[model samples]
Target: MTQSPAPLPPPKQRRHLREAASLTQAQVAERMGVTGETVHAWESGRTTPRGRRREAYAKLLASLTKADMVTNTQEAAPPPQVTVCLNKKPNPRRAVSAPTPAPITPTPITPAPITSAPITSTTRTPATRTPASTSAPVAVAAHGPVPASETEPAPLTPLTPAQAFDALYAFCAPALVRQTYLLSGRRELARESVEQAFQLAWQRWPEVAVDRDPAGWVRATAYEYALSPWHRFRPRYRHPEPPPADASDRALLDVLLTLPAPYRRTLLLYDGVGLDLPETAAETEASTPAAANRLLNAREAVAARLPELANPTALHRRLAELASAERLRAAEPTTVRAGSERRARFWTRAAVAFTVAIIGATALTVRTAPTRYEPPVPPGETVQGIPPRSAPGTLSDAELKLRAKLRSGILHGPQRLIPLAE
Candidate 1:
């Protein structure tokens, strides 16, 4: 019966071993004849290797573990120091009478433990070694005490939020501005994009500070802002910025602008920024093959127009030179941080005001509204209580006589006359 296979280390230990060996997942995958994703899955415990592959991976991890052990052991031991003594010819009588002194052995000092207290400069005095006897010279080999600063480095103080934000801005803003210029071909817009990206970073410092790659976060933001199609609609950016003064530079910028935005970004990230294909793909939000295709297309377009830049080295150099020549500058970190805070305050106040206005309108409507519902009255119908007036016709004999009497009696004004009966 075959022996059971050896158990593998835990998933976390497997990843740590690989990192200790300074090997990337892709590198390990290539050696193991598997896809990078497979190695990633193995490390992440999503899947396990089987058969010969399992045996091979176990062996690889074992070797890495042994290597790490050896390295740690070597680092822990202090180096030995040797002192040689030179002596002149001794008198025979004196040499015989004097006893040979025992060699001095220096005691090793244990390294100091690190603490969180602030580091201060202090003078260190070296301990002098004493020999057993002064009559005869003796060579001594001993380990010197390691310097406190070297053995136990002071722990770094954690940066405050503002300090961290400023540091990140100072480190990335200048280079990002240059990169944005290549993406958009507008110096002013490039500056604006970098500033806007920093402002956004300041607004979300907590998220950005804890990110694995804060520079990449800001870079992606700047690129997205710089290459926004909405910029085309802005009156200031509707017309293209003036081309570079040099004819070659002008041709290069024109060619870069001709490519699709995605292709241009991929090319710049891969070639100009010195990022590998995988990283460029991740940043551009595309697959490795798609990013490669875009890069190829972009390079071909540029090479067709400017054949001198056909080589990637030459192209990268040209891109760098082109960007450096432009007068791109980023706003101060303090300014960007203040602006972000101001913008946030403005929006917050506006929201509060809008809510208050809505509440007031609701209250006013409630107060003025008719509480009780009243049914409207319908139109009145004609009543038949009074008979309709008779139309003009020949009067009866009695009616005519009465009318003539009334007309004759009431002629004088103030007299009250009674109606006469016919």
Candidate 2:
């Protein structure tokens, strides 16, 4: 029978051992004749090594573990000691000249009477002040020299919420306005977008202040606002803005605008802003490969339009120049903050009014509505009478004869007897 192979440590342990041995995944993969991704998979426990590779990886891990143990032991070992001659018998011969003199007793002095001086309020002075004269030196001597630590400058106090917000706005607003201008060809819209973004940031300063990248937060907001589809429908933005005065700038801007919105944004983030691929993908909310494709397509389109911008460096430079050539200034931080507050109040009031209106309408409907259901009366129908009436026809012969006799005789016999009907 064949001998059984040794069991390997857990994946986490294997990774720890490799790292403790100062070996990267790539280095381990190279040694193991496997790919770095394979090693990563193994370390991450996503997949396990198998067959001969497993055995070899196990041996490598064991060796690393042993080496790590040895290193730890060495580090934990005590330091070596050295002997000193001062503790030896050298003092017996060298210091035998005379017995050591006894230390003299210190003389006791009476304490002076303490005098309490009236406290006076004085204005503060600078930490480092020059001595006015020899007479001023008395105060210094009385206090003794200030310690080096005390003379050192104090640490800075943390910034207040408003100050911090203002600083962040001042630092990022100008560049953000320029970036927004590139995103949206309209300078006025660009300025408005940036101011709006900062206003939002100020409104959410608590969340934004704690965020890792406040500028990135603001940039994303501004970009979203600048590229909003609603802007096209607005009357102010219905008409296209005037092109740049410079011919080259106009041509470049036109080309940039021709590309699709996502592709343009991805290209600007990657090339214009100099963000790496992953960061660009993150900001644009696209996969790395997708962002890469967008960037490639955008660059190709621009190059097709203006061959001079084929080089990425030239493209970036041209984009920067194009954005800078346009004068886009952002609103003041105070103005933005004030606008945000005012907008917030207006919306809040509008919401309250809407809620009140809804409640009143509901109350009115409930009050006016019928309390009980009433079935509607059915439509009228014709009913037969007790005796049915017959249809009329021609008169009888006898009746017709009598009618004719009366009409013929009535003119002469009205005064005489009228009993002639038989």
Candidate 3:
């Protein structure tokens, strides 16, 4: 008896799906809006996603795994080729001036039996058709036999909102991260920006999935998030290594980095990420004409260093190919450590408290602070120095007492002077 392969354990299965999707536990947690421990628990089989969460979990796994399977199958299978026969055999019954046959009375005819022989055309010109045994019917046109390579598979049926989101994430996440990386010049930040954008997209997927260009919407959202100034206050990005780069790419990147931010982003969008001028402008928040001008200027800047890139067409093509190859590995989210969220919460509360304290202190100081101080003076009192009045011609009782005290040496200075108003 043949032995069957062992089924994957729950933890292994969960890890396999996560890794296959190029996602980290933190990313899954963020998508599920749960803590990393919850995801870990589910993956470890200590717990399982239940109810609607289970439904979502299954959908996520199916979408990513299916996408990978499709890609792999396509890569492994070779394209089908159809052999076209050019020789046209003349019909033995056909004559240059054969008289038309008369119409006979209608009669019931037995259907011909299916045969193994190749089906041939009854007309003067013989048509080539594949034998039924070989493959499905090859679509033939009146003009000529259609090449097998020309045929395309039927488009996929519309997916539900959740499936659509998962599919979108699987298909576009890597590409989106690459585009954002080229724009931001930071690999980890690029990933975060894309993740944040995808998070937003997941929340509003009903509107996003139905858009004409869902990928474009995601990319645009990422670009906007990457450029946001508030991103600085968030945890800094850390990565094991930078995205791979070749000599030519490194050279181009070095030169590209020298360009101003607007020009750099415009160039990357137009050439690297393959956005059109209008889309680029919309993403960069500029007009089409302005985008065109920036692109022209950016190309000139790049061409100045790499003279071979002077041709706009060649430059766009080369840059687009180079940039599309940069698939960033999902960085392990470091900030998701236990209690980090709690720490963040605590800091947030602390910051609010600090702000309130500062404001209260400022208001109290303003309310209680003394205004420009001035000594109070009796009403009608002259604040100015007055010249001493002429000595009194006659001494009053107080002056007599002062004189006696002065004579007795009890008084000093000018008061002790004799003839004190005598």
> What is candidate 3's CA lDDT for residue 250?
76
Q: Candidate 3, residues 304-375: lDDT per residue as tens digits?
A: 899999986687666656555565654322222223345557878999999999999999999999899888
Runs with alpha carbons beyond 4 Å of true place in candidate 3: 1-162, 203-212, 227-245, 324-327, 331-422
Q: What are the per-residue Cα lDDT tens digits for candidate 2 across 1-422?
A: 98677688887798668657656565787798854445655765656877898899888988998898876776566533222344456544553332222222222211111111011111111112222222221112233545757644465566678877877776567777777787888889888998889888888888888765676788899999999998878998888988899999999989988999999899888777656576678889999999999999999999999999999989987887887787777788888889999988998999999999999999999999999999999999878776777897788999899789778777564587466745
The better-scoring model by lDDT among 2 and 3 is 2
The candidate, 1 or 2, that scores higher on TM-score is 1
Off-target runs (Cα >4 Å) in candidate 2 are 1-140, 145-155, 378-422
- Measure candidate 2: CA RMSD: 18.8
lDDT of each: 0.74, 0.73, 0.61
Per-model TM-score on C-alpha atoms: 0.60, 0.58, 0.41
TM-score: the better of candidates 2 and 3:
2
Identify the runs in model 1 with alpha carbons over 4 angstroms from their true place: 1-71, 74-154, 238-240, 375-422
- Give the worst 10-residue stretch by lDDT in candidate 2: 111-120
> The CA-based lDDT of model 3 is what?
0.61
Model 1: lDDT of residue 415 = 62
